[model samples]
Target: MDNLQRIDYLLHTNALDEMGKNELISILLDEYGSKIVRLAYIYVKDQGKAEDIAQEVFLKCYEKLDQYRQEASIETWLSKIAINICRDYLRSGWFKYFARGVIDTFPYLKHKETPELKLIEQMENEKLMQAVFSLPQKYREVIILHYYMEYSTKQIGDLLAIKSVSVRSRLARAREKLQKKLETGEGS
Candidate 1:
């Protein structure tokens, strides 16, 4: 059987032995590593730390696989796990390590392109992302979920365990913060 079939079987039968579990994890990591790592990096802003966080997320998923109820798509469940892991990591004060000198060390800021338009677009996108990242955690989480992950307010509220009104408030605050950053050419 193909990998997806194996994973589906393991999940449905709830009979995944250690080896089956390991194989499932291997398949997920192979398929989703880059996307998970990128999302973590966007949250934490450090490549190394992001990779570590992604690995931790997968570990958590493996440990909790038996609890998954298939209420949502597997990808959504995994993303919810990843986002929670990132939020917990942010709450742990580790982000300070990444925040230090990040502006100076930002790789995207150093890029050069021969095409002036493309370069401008890249710079603008980088600036916007930086601004988003600089928002307060409450605002940042909503914005990232809404924009980066394309989650609706209701979905975000459900994932974050907040009311939809709270999500809307946070999203509004985030947009206000982003606008201020763009207008003032300042992050944070």
Candidate 2:
């Protein structure tokens, strides 16, 4: 059988012992770790904390592998787990502290550049990212999932456990908010 089939059989048959589970988790992590980390970082706005949250999500997935119902693709299941973990992390008091700091920071740091025009471009990118990060969590989450992660509305809805209509509505709202912010230079 193929690798996915083997994983499906192992997961379904409850045959994954600790070592097997570790191997499976390793594979999944290797494939999805950067994406999860990026999602968490965008949500939390702190790289260190985002890494911690992503690790926790993977641990939960490993522990609960047998609980997967196979109603969705394994990637979808993993995305759901990651989103839930990020949401819970956002709701914590630590998130409040971090969020406040992130908002108050105003323009984010830009990469160093030798040419003046390149530096301006770097600063523009930083400003754009800061604006995105300043948006309300609901709007920011949908924007990040759709734009940054390049997830379609249906896929985002599945990962977020929301309806596709809800995802589309949120995406529209997020775009409006971002446009307004850009036009007025509010977050810049």
lDDT of candidate 2 over 46-163, digit per residue (tens):
6677789889989889888878888887777887887888788778887678666755575443222224325325545866776787898888888878877789999988887789
Clashing pairs in 1: none
TM-score of each: 0.74, 0.79
Task: Give the Cα-based TM-score of candidate 1 against the true structure.
Answer: 0.74
The true-structure Cα RMSD of candidate 1 reads 4.7
Candidate 2 local distance difference test against the native:
0.77
lDDT of each: 0.76, 0.77
Residue runs of model 1 more than 4 Å from their true location after superposition: 1-6, 93-124
Q: How high is the lDDT of residue 165 in model 1?
A: 97
